[model samples]
Target chain A: MNKTIIEIVDSLEVSKVYAELSDPQSGGICVFVGTVREVTQGETVVALEFETYRNMALKEMEKIALEAVEKWQLNKVVIRHAIGAKKVEDPVVVVGASAPHRDACFEACRYLIDTLKERVPIWKKEIFKNKTVWVSAHP
Target chain B: MEILLFGIAKDIVGKSKIQFAAGEGQPTSVKELRQTLESAYPDLGRLSSMAVAVNSEYVRDELILKPGDEIAIIPPVSGG
Candidate 1:
């Protein structure tokens, strides 16, 4: 409702978020992507499964956007996180912010991801051939 | 009274919306609500950890609940 102020998508296509942030009026657009690496805490991760209480996840995401806007007085923000199964090298989370200048965009985008990691209700389970671990929080 | 439920809390209860009586002159705290939840639905007690938030702000057990306030019971999860 606020000029596409924030977009949350549950898809694997994260590059589109970059394209959306490339508006001419926005002098600064910051992007952050969280990818699935081959290892975590010395263990090789075969794949990762992300789960969310959909309704509350969305609410928490929106809350993040609102807080960013209020805190930095930014122009717009976008956050997208992939759900279900994701393999190595796949992009799992994407966050972007666009503003009149670069510093605010970068700061706000970073804050959004950091706070979202701490506050959002999404969960991830790492799957390996020999064992599985449920992570309670992201480092 | 409206109770804010999220994540594992919603899953255990099988519904996102929860309602309870707010008796006259009795205010509910986050801890009390959690105890009530564990009593009413035993499965929630098994969760690893949970944090309570009122209107998107995390608070301690002594935080009082108000009618119509959004509440979220956050369970720790590994996510980015």
Candidate 2:
């Protein structure tokens, strides 16, 4: 069976996601990690607080997975996002896709992250040295 | 009368669920609800630039809200 959406936002283990996609039938598996940066918009960010409408966020994520399955002919997919407060260099999001070929895996993984950034309602608050600013939803 | 709140809206409202009364067939646009929310909780008025989404779709201020619609007020995001 093909995997689609796996959503979480706490300290996620990379090995666990890799293990889940290690299938004998799949020829390629691609993974992407989005980390919290120390600076944003030229400001020194101290930390970030991420929040989401949990239930709806999951539903939207699932929809993305289904779309990938149909569009990429993939064997499986996984997406995890961390919620709450996070510091710099922390893994905030992870996405993995497995397909029969490397090209499909790469394409699907990129599409998944890009689409999630545009569609997901998850928001982030940047706590800078001087003040706090809110930014647009990103994956 | 029920609107699903999310993100900062859920935090500011101090609850995830809320009920509002709308006149018969008089759509509750995001703009109208913002005014009502400000009256109910003046503190939220400070966040004047927040956006609204109806039924998981981001919409303009004039979009009419229906009963049982999941309404979300989203602030700007700051994620990587």
TM-score for each candidate, following the candidate numbering = 0.72, 0.77
Query: lDDT per residue, candidate 1, A1-139, as tens digits?
Result: 3623443355568757777776666888898999999988888999988877566677778888888878776767787788888899998888888888888898998998998888777778888889876675322
Off by over 4 Å in 2: A137-139, B2-19, B22-66, B75-80
Q: Write the per-residue lDDT of candidate 2 for residues B1-80, one digit (tens) a residue.
A: 66565555666788877776567534468888777776776656666356667777678888877667778766543333
Candidate 1: lDDT of B22? 64
Worst 10 residues of 1 chain A by lDDT: A1-10
iRMSD, per candidate, in listed order: 4.3, 5.1
- The deviation in Å at residue B62 for candidate 1 is 5.0
lDDT of each: 0.76, 0.75
